[model samples]
Target: MILSTASSSQANAAFWRFLATRLLVSLLTLLAVSFMIYGLIELMPGDYAERELFRKYSGTGVTITQAEIDRVRADLGLDRPFLVRYGEWLWNVVTRLDFGPAFRVETSVNALIGDKFFYTFVLVVGAMLISYIVAIPVGIWVASRKSGIGDGVVTLLSYLGLALPNFAIALVLLMLNAFVFDLDVTGLVSQEFRDAPWSMAKFLDFLGHAYIPLLVLGWSTTAFQLQTMRGLMKDEMGKLYVTAAQARGFSGWPMLIKYPARHAVMPIVSTIGFDFSRSFNELPIVASILVLGELGQELLLAFLDADQNTAAGILVCITSVIIAANFLSDLLVAALDPRVRMRGGR
Candidate 1:
């Protein structure tokens, strides 16, 4: 027993080392994305100050002196060579936790993150909760039925979800809420209410607006999970070992609990981290339809109308969020799967 425990502890330690290595790679990828953002910003047809000049110095006497533009560039650190600027930005970002500041928005980049992150978290987490709650039972039902009528129904449902876009789903739900349910979801809180605070009223109001996101995201994945699990179960059930278990009078529950489900769970858990991360990307479409004051809508605005600085800050925040999600996913998968430890793959 001691020998087995020591071996398991050694294996776990090695697994964490592999995970650390994988995280280094992911961090490098994020750094590359940041560099790309910097390059593109530098490559913009005009200086970063050009847009601000137009907005601030609008109509008459807009003939800005070249020296002034150069001064602005120097202030923004844009006068530096692209590589130099990128290195400084990367170093400052990673070490000092300074992503600089947004040129357009008055708020600090980190402040902006704090403002919108909770909403994004609330939306995505709600959706994920609903997906699992619905998907798990549906997957089991389809697997138990195995190529029968229930499975056919689950397959069709999955296809329908896979076919529909989030925007389409959100829009349909919005129209229904407005026209049919008359829910007044536009106000995330009540019309009389204004802020999100810890209160029963706020909690209930949040829940009211949460359903559309929950339903759209949850329903989108149910089908895919159902199909994946069903196929996995089918494959496992067909194994010679499983046949022997059945012949030895092992019951259905034992076969499912001990055999197929355990084997099938690795793939599903592997995807959960990805799915959770993907929810952030999908936030904009839902935000657009519902007119929610969330990060998705904010990000779209940052890219579309806000200046380069604002967009860059948003991009930085987004990149950080994505990297964190991916890292968490890797850790979750490592923890969930023993084979992952043996293979030295995060």
Candidate 2:
């Protein structure tokens, strides 16, 4: 009883220590990203309101005088020192999750991002789910088959997937639908449900419309996972322990699963951190091609429009998400592989 209690206590202490280390690292990473984003925003050519007003008045025979620009800048607090503005924005984020309003639209940053964020999150998660579901079994089968015809075909398909970018996939599908199928697979939902509130019909419409985008986003990831899993499993199978297991008369699926597959899964586990960090950044072109209005689209518009607060809010949100994912991934890897936990402790 005493040994069990001590062991549990020690494990709990180690887990908390590991968590603390990850939290500190995540916080520092977020701060560094925020600083870089703020500095870049400061270095941009003009404030959001100025450029927008120029667009609004430039061809209308109304001169946007320097006086008008200055007044607008003053009113928007754009003339404040960079550090001061950054501090205020940071405080607002910390205190109230308020990243400020869109300079032209006059909507809160969160309000502008809320629905789009959900869409992007769903897109990324759906892609990842599809990638893993297809990749793992196919990868294992190909690795086990090695030089068989099925393996060859799957290998060719994976290579093709890697060669084709998501945008190319989107373009090809779009053209095929346009020229051959007479199908309209361009957007997330039909025109009727575009602005309609959520309903059973809307949800079903979304499912119907979501498959193409999901395929565009997920295909490459699935291919990459397949290649990675195949290589790792192949390597693991060739190791001395696998040879020993074979010598012990465990020759087929049992040997593969009991000996090699468990070891091969670690790299895939570790990649979750990078994958989570990257999901939001990938497939922007795909999103644009499909008119999905995902977060990547919103971020691009925010940057082009010089909506610094909106852009900053997005950066913070993305960074926070990545950090949280990293933290979780670390714990997951540690749980799956004791080596990682030991290394972390050291």
Task: Report every candidate's CA lDDT.
Answer: 0.70, 0.81
**TM-score of each predicted structure versus truth:** 0.83, 0.90
User: Can you tell me which runs of candidate 2 are displaced by over 4 Å?
Assistant: 1-12, 246-255
Maximum-lDDT candidate: 2
Model 2 Cα lDDT, one tens digit per residue, 184-293: 98878899997888899998988888899888888888898899999999888788998888888997777777778878877776676677666676657788888886
For all predictions, the C-alpha RMSD in Å is: 3.3, 2.5
Clashing pairs in 2: none
Provide the global lDDT of candidate 1 against the true structure: 0.70
Q: Model 1, 150-186: lDDT tens per residue?
A: 7777788888888998889888888888899776676
Which 10-residue window in model 2 sums to the lowest lDDT?
Answer: 337-346
Q: Rate residue 344 of model 1 by lDDT.
A: 67
